[model samples]
Target: MRRLMKLGAFALVLGLLWSCQDSNEGQQPQLEEVPDEVLAQVANLGFNADEVKMYDGVLFIEGDIRITLDQLEKMSPSDGLPVEEHYHTDNLVTGTPRTINVYVQNMPQKYVDATDIAIDRYNDESLNLTFNRVSSSGQADITIRASPWYYYWFGILGSAGFPENGDPYGTILMTRGYYDNVSNINGLATTIAHEMGHCIGFRHTDYMDRSYSCGGSPDDEGDGGVGANHIPGTPTGPSANSWMLACGSPEGDRPFTADDKTALGYVY
Candidate 1:
């Protein structure tokens, strides 16, 4: 009788677990269909169109390049070098010598100060493109905001949007959890600067090889047109101190390396 009772209890728990699984499966959201043009644009970027999907009104391609529905409609596809060929975007920020206003979303004063430091770094470069801090989101070209705790699971400090179709470039999403955990001011500043590189159409310096930072099989991002465009004058080999490296360390507070300056100068 004791053995029978134990088996019965185990069966009951199993049944409850199965029921919960079914309930959760029923709650799963369905993916929204994307427009053919949007798919085509993604293909032009060297991503597979079939892999494209819309969720929560945002279009995700190649596991990155978040685009809002409105931004999708406005995107103009252009032919460019693939991830293997280049590291800069064909869709660069318009208006030569334009001032890009950056706004920091309401957060800790440290984040705001960090952003200011990043801005100073760029402004000091004396490049044609300029960065300025703005108090209002309405007046800003790029809005820097914090991400929820869940974002830390991706193991990235921050992410940024690329410039598309004359849209106000893209947003910078900084992981608050990562920042709070690491109190390195220069490292945080480097993180902000790295994302800013993405906003201005720069890809990872080691776009072809993420092993140095990400520690995985070398990723070409995609062969052919989907890969990153190699900037002229930048070294073909990997750069250890590039501010645009995909991953960052708490101790790695990289200012712009010589190669980084050359690439930025050549493009912007």
Candidate 2:
């Protein structure tokens, strides 16, 4: 199954994938251009290295998740998960209230507003995580920027990375066509919150099987050695309407469902 209109966190790279099309390698060209070392490293992490691609001089997996060479070289691997539960990465922002300052660059007004909506949804919760959008990029801990290029493929929504060293992933790159393609601000807000979920260490609620949310084929987004540890207290069965599902639809409007809150609270 392909993760539709999904994005990811940075830590996933040297370690794993943070994307909308988690298991389905996108139809984008230039797979041949990605270096063998990149492919080998991605493969080592349990991703589909054969589907890896190069975009705008950056290595991307699944679709838009960036994998830096420096990070690749420094990455270490591991494994071991709870029998059944929600998932998150090993590295997470540390604190009772992990307040993340967000900044947007060149995003449409709709997306800017959607970011606020998503942030509010997170802040309203009693979890340890909180997001506050800053007017200046310099004042932010995470900067969300619009991709320089427009969307030419079907599921090209956005991309990101996982948290590292007790800090939220540094940046989130929204595909330029996202605002235009999604049906409403909440859909965009869902996408925004989803990517942030990766930054703060949340994995897809359906990580074990992308086909659960995204149809096509059943695929597991492997742990990538970073650990997709199950969050305690979350359901062992499917979580309906979670913002962190592997994919987002054009009209999708999921906003912090009850189980999502449980996952957030359990992790933080």
lDDT of 1: 0.60
How high a TM-score does candidate 1 get? 0.71
TM-score of each: 0.71, 0.78
Please provide, for model 1 over 1-268, each residue's C-alpha lDDT reduced to its tens digit, 9 standing for 90 to 100. 0000111123333333231111333333556788787776665555435445566677754333456777655544343422321356556777777899999997688878878888898888898888999999999889988753323332223456666654445588765544554476777777777677767766666555655555656655443353355678777766767886655464457888878887777777
**TM-score for candidate 2, residues paired by index:** 0.78
Off by over 4 Å in 1: 1-44, 47-65, 68-89, 148-157, 226-230
Candidate with best TM-score: 2
